[model samples]
Target: MRISVKLASICLMLVLLLTITTPAFAATTNPVLSVTGTTVAPVASVTPTTATAPLMPGDTGTVVVTLTNTLKSPGTGNTTVITESHQNVYPPTAGSGITTTRQTQTSSSDGSSGACELKFVNLLSEGPIHVQNAAYTDVGYLGLGDSAQFQFTIKVDDSAADGKYYLPLKVKTDNDECYVNQVVPVVIDSTQPRLVLNDAPSKLGTSRGNIIIDVVNYRSSGINSASVIPEGAEFTFKPRAEYTVGSIGAGEMYTVTFETSSKNATYTGNPSFVLKYKNGDNWHQTAPLVVGMEPKTDAAAAGNGGGDNTLLILGGVILVVLVLIGGVYLFMRSQRSKK
Candidate 1:
C-alpha cells in the first residue's frame, strides 16, 4: 500500500507539471514557415490601379497596390504586426516622363489575431508621363495566421511625352519578397500639318504689258479669294470668277494680268509690267507676270515732208494746156476780120 501511494503521488505531480507547460504548446496549433502577400483589389478596382489609361500630362491620378500574406503561424497561432512601404520605378531612360513616388503606410495596427489586415496610404510622384506605385512591405512578428494588405496611390504629370512606359513593383512580407512587372504605354501627338504653295507671283502692277499669270490650287479643292489683300487694286482679270478660287479644285488654274508700269527688284522700267498672285493658308508669296511686253507709240509719225513738190508739178501742166486753147481762138478771130 505504501509503494502504491508513492507511485500515485509521483504520477499526479507529473500530470500537473505537464498541464502547466502544455497550455503554451496547445495554445499554438501550428508553426508559421513563411510570409507571403498578394494584392486584394476592391471589386470595382480589379485592375489594382485606379485607372489603366496612359497617364495624361500635367494630370494628377491615383493607383492601388495590394499585398497579402501566404503563410499561417503555428503553436500560438499567428500574432504578428505588418507594415508596408512604397516606391516608384521610373522609365529606363533619364528625363523620361516616367517617374515614381513612395507611399507612406497610412495605417497598419490592428489588435485582432486574425486572417486579415490592410494598410492604406497616399502616394505622389510628379512630372509628365507614366509610372507606378508599388506596395513593398513585410509581415512582422509572424506567429500564426499572419497576413497583411497594402494599398497605395500615385500621380502622373501632364507634360509627359507619348510612348510606352514600364512600371515595375515589388511586394514583401517579413524576409520573403516578390516582384511585379507591368508595362504602361504613353502616346503623344505633336505634329502639325504643312501648307505649300504651287505657284508664286514675282511682281505687282496696273498695266497689261508687264505680267500675265495662271494660278492654281495648292492643297485642297479650293481657296478663299476674300483673303485677297490691297482691296480694289484695279484687277484686269477676275480672280474669283475665272478661277472659282473659293472652290479652286486641286490642280485647277486661273489667269491674271500685270501692266507695263510694273517694277522688278532692281528696275522700275515702265517698259515692262508684272502681275502678282499670292495664295496660301498664310497667304504668303507673289508670282512674276507671264504677260507679253510691247513698245508704245503716239500719233506724231504722219503729215510732213515731200508731198508739196508733187502738187506744184501737176498745176503747171494744166496751165500749159489752157494757153494753147486760147491761141487757136485768136487766130480764128483774125481770119474772119480779113474776109
Candidate 2:
C-alpha cells in the first residue's frame, strides 16, 4: 500500500511539472518577425553650354551647367524598429530548482518620400583653364522632374593651345551616398584678324592722296561689323576716321581706301592703322601698323619734268630781256657819236 501511494504522488508531480514547463517551451520556440521598406535613389542628368564663340587665350568667361533630376518619383529613406522579450520560470521543488527561460525579438522598418538633398557641387580646373569661384555648398534639395542651373567663371591661360579641353564637374547628394562625375568640353582659339598695309604711297605730299589697306582674317571663323581707323600726328583722314569694312570671312581679305591729307607740308612722321571687328559677340582690335611718310617740296610735289621745264623757260626769258637792253644801249651810244 505504501508503494502504491508513492507511485501516485510521483505521477502527480510529473504531470504538474509538464503543465508548468509547456508554456515556457512554447515561448522559447516563438519565431522573430521582421519587416522592411525600401525606395529607389534619385537620378540626375548634367548638360553644359558654352558661348557662341570659342574661348580666346587669356580670356575670362562663364560656363553654364544644367542639372536635372530624372527620377519620376521622389526618393525615400529607410527606418527600422526592434523589439525583444525574455521569460524565466523556477521549478516549485527540490535541492536545485529547475529553471526555464524564453526570448522573443521583432523588427520593423518604415520609409518616407521627398526630394533629394544636394550637398555640394564643384568644378575642377584642368590644364590651362582655371576656376575663379569656390565650390557650391549646401545647395538645398532637388525635386522630381526639376532642373537647376549653375554658372562658373573661368579664365584661360595665355599660353593655352588651340584645341578642345575638358573640365571635370563633381556633384554629391544624399549624404554622399550618391555621386556624379562628368566632363564638360570647351574650345580654345587664339587666332584673330590681321590688318596690313597692302598699297600705300611712299611719300604723302601736301595734296590729298589715297591710302589703301588690306584686312586679312587669319582666324578659322568669320567676323562682322568690321571697321578701320587711321592714326597719325600730322594728317587728316576723309571722309571719316572710322571706315566701315562690313564683314570678312575666314581666311579672306578685304581692301579699304582712305583719302588722307597732310596737315603741314614739311611734316615728316609715321602713320598707323587699326582694325576693329566683332568675332561672335565680342569685339577685338588689332595692334596698330606703323607706316612712314616722307615730306615733299612744292616743286617736287608737282610733276618733276614739268617743274624743270618751267625753271629753264624762265631763265631763257631773262637772258633774252638782258640781251635786248644791252643792244638798245649800244644803239643810243652810236647815235650820239654820229651827232
List the candidates' TM-scores in order.
Answer: 0.24, 0.59
Candidate 2 similarity to native, TM-score: 0.59
Candidate models: Cα lDDT each:
0.35, 0.67
lDDT string for model 2 (261-306, tens) is 7886656577788998775445678999787677555555467769
Task: Judge candidate 2 at residue 72 and give its lDDT.
Answer: 58
Pairs of residues clashing in candidate 2: none
Query: Which candidate's TM-score is highest?
Result: 2
Lowest summed lDDT over 10 consecutive residues: which window, candidate 1?
A: 295-304
